[model samples]
Target chain A: MKHRGCGKDLAKVSEFIDGGLPAAMCRRIRAHMDDCRPCRDFVASLRRAMALHRAQGRAPSPPPLAKAELRDALRSCTAALKKRKPR
Target chain B: MPESESALISRSREGDPAAFESLVRRYEDRIYRLAKNVCAGAPAEADDVYQETFLTAFKKLRTFRGGSGLGTWLYRIASNLCFMRLRSNKRRPFVAALDLPSGEGLRLPADSIPTPEQAAGKRELAEAVARALKLLPVDYRLVLTLRDVEGLSNEETAKVLKVSVAAVKSRLHRGRLFMRERLAALSEGAA
Candidate 1:
């Protein structure tokens, strides 16, 4: 439960997991995790949570009826614009 | 060959309805997805956000300088509309303290390591995750949805949110930690 020394390094764990950090920084984080059990658990769980969300795929597409409505609305808007410009 | 997006943009700006429609068709799904996630509690609001995003883009197409990709531009518009709708509805405050202390909240129990396989099989856990996402501060939720759910790159996310990359990283880090803690608590409660 000792979190005093782990705060700064733990903040970078997200970047490290995403491979967004430089190699040397990654090395430093790995070194930190090796000694900090709480940070290690937090990193593992965060990775798992992210993986779960990714597995769910993108949000669902709009329904077909909604798509049709949007298309109609856009058509009307475009028609209005064309009338105004007369092109 | 099909017209490039830039060509489509040019044509749309010239008052070609078909060309404009093409642009909308190309991005409607993704824009709608962003809206759905941002307005998770209100399907109707999500629809409004999606429609307004495209309509606004159309009206302003002449102003689009092609500095950002069409998709990025569309995302920026949609994200703004979503934020406005959220704010007007008064369901959630637009600004929460983003400077949350790191690693100060709930810790994941060492023994209960979550795996993708376990999460996949547990419908309640998935529901819990969805609920947790909705409960996040809007800023954190938007960051998570863009980065994690929609698979936008960090750079793209920063562009959509109009924030620095460091800010995106900071919000994303805090958001993920928050979700992890929520999921851990839910799992413990269910166990």
Candidate 2:
């Protein structure tokens, strides 16, 4: 895939996959990929990797005890702020 | 009807605890998840970032000005705290080794592409993803988490990170490549 323009085109593969490129640019990239084996493989692999992460969903949330602690802390902080307010 | 976010903010700024608490509840899970992703190796620090983000937001509510959305505001605060904690601990930013070996060996074999079900069932692969993510610099990790894991758009992620959309795209592309290389190696090893 080290062809003359392969590097330049591959650099845009991410944006290409994301549809961030202009329509004509996407067509050009697509045409380039049709003849480029490594670039095609790379794009496929990158897409799969992205899909894997997307499927992984959100990171684990704070634990229940931690959530409770945060709530309590916010409550106290807000209460103190309320008390300090001028009439 | 549920109270609008601006209304909630108005009450919150006036020292209304319930209103502030309502805002907190709306975003705590997301802020915590962001903290966890940004501070993957430091559970305690994640908690601190999560706690401090809301606390700091509360203290600074008057100055929020609504220039950005509230969620972006909270994300900015949390991200700053995460980076500050890393800096204080002398953890330098990770620069990806873009010069890593390429060619046939680095390509992901087609058969290894896991279906969603396969991906979900493969604990080792999930761990590989997590491990690879942890190896990325905080900037890349944060971008990947917000843009990929949390499903925020590139523009939204840029707003949170206070970078341009171009910067977000660059980071996300490089980060995804780094992760793909790591996962390819894992698949090869398992084969």
Candidate 3:
């Protein structure tokens, strides 16, 4: 078997975080991170960045203007439908 | 029982505007945020994309054949509109450095502890994140937002972006690296 260097493992770090790898492979990466300080820091950083991004998603609600415009459009579509219906 | 999305979709396809409106209400916030992020936090651009997405979805509602969830379908529409707008305006895509030279000597201690309270106040952290995200190229930003931010599964994200799963993963990996490096600076500043 070919030796998987830090570069290769680092490339797959996201996959590992995602649980996309097989259990054995996950264990291998875990073992590698245990001894590899750089890989450890890299994975830590990736996880933190993702967490921050997710937080960013939660901070802002959809702007009110966008919602109002969409509602208005829906109402217009509804009005058009009513106009076409036989009374 | 309340109508399932499929039933709502059925009624929507039959010219029931209320049904369609309900669907829009269900997904409007998500679609808007996606647009906002895809437009790199430009509110005006986000608003345009949000409105256009629903209008397009409304115009083409009949083409929806219950293959995917309503959210997934809407995301596909929103994603397309966002990218189209970005391309028409000739925004440069951010190119990621695929081969990271090494993390060996880099001393970014701020990467380790990153809870909301520890890094910065919630609002500050969010602003930092938004600023960092905006610096990324559209493709990388989209991939990161979909997977990491929007909480979409890899397969679902690939479907939304109309890319292969491998492509999604590759983009996601590179995007993650870009975001990590960018945010590390913010984190250090905040600390």
User: For model 1 chain B, where is the 10-residue window of minimal lDDT?
Assistant: B95-104
Sorted into a CAPRI-style docking class, model 2 comes out as acceptable
Worst 10 residues of 3 chain B by lDDT: B100-109
- lDDT for each residue of candidate 3 in A1-87, tens digit (9 for 90 to 100): 123477778778889998999999999999987887667777776776777677667536667776787779877876786789797
The local lDDT score (0 to 100) that residue B139 gets in candidate 2 is 84
Candidate 3 stretches with Cα past 4 Å from truth are A1-4, A81-87, B88-121, B189-191
How displaced is residue B18 in candidate 3, in Å?
A: 1.7
- For residues B7-85, write the lDDT of model 1, one tens digit per residue: 9999888888889888888898889888887786577988889888988998899899999899999999998887787
- For candidate 3, give the lDDT of residue B59: 79
**Predicted candidate 1, C-alpha RMSD:** 5.2
Candidate order, lDDT descending: 2, 1, 3
Clashing pairs in 1: none
Every candidate's TM-score, chain A alone: 0.79, 0.85, 0.80
Encode model 3's per-residue lDDT on B66-145: one tens digit a residue: 67777888999988887777764436566554444223222222445568664656556666667777776666677887
User: In model 1 chain A, which range of ten residues has the least summed lDDT?
Assistant: A51-60
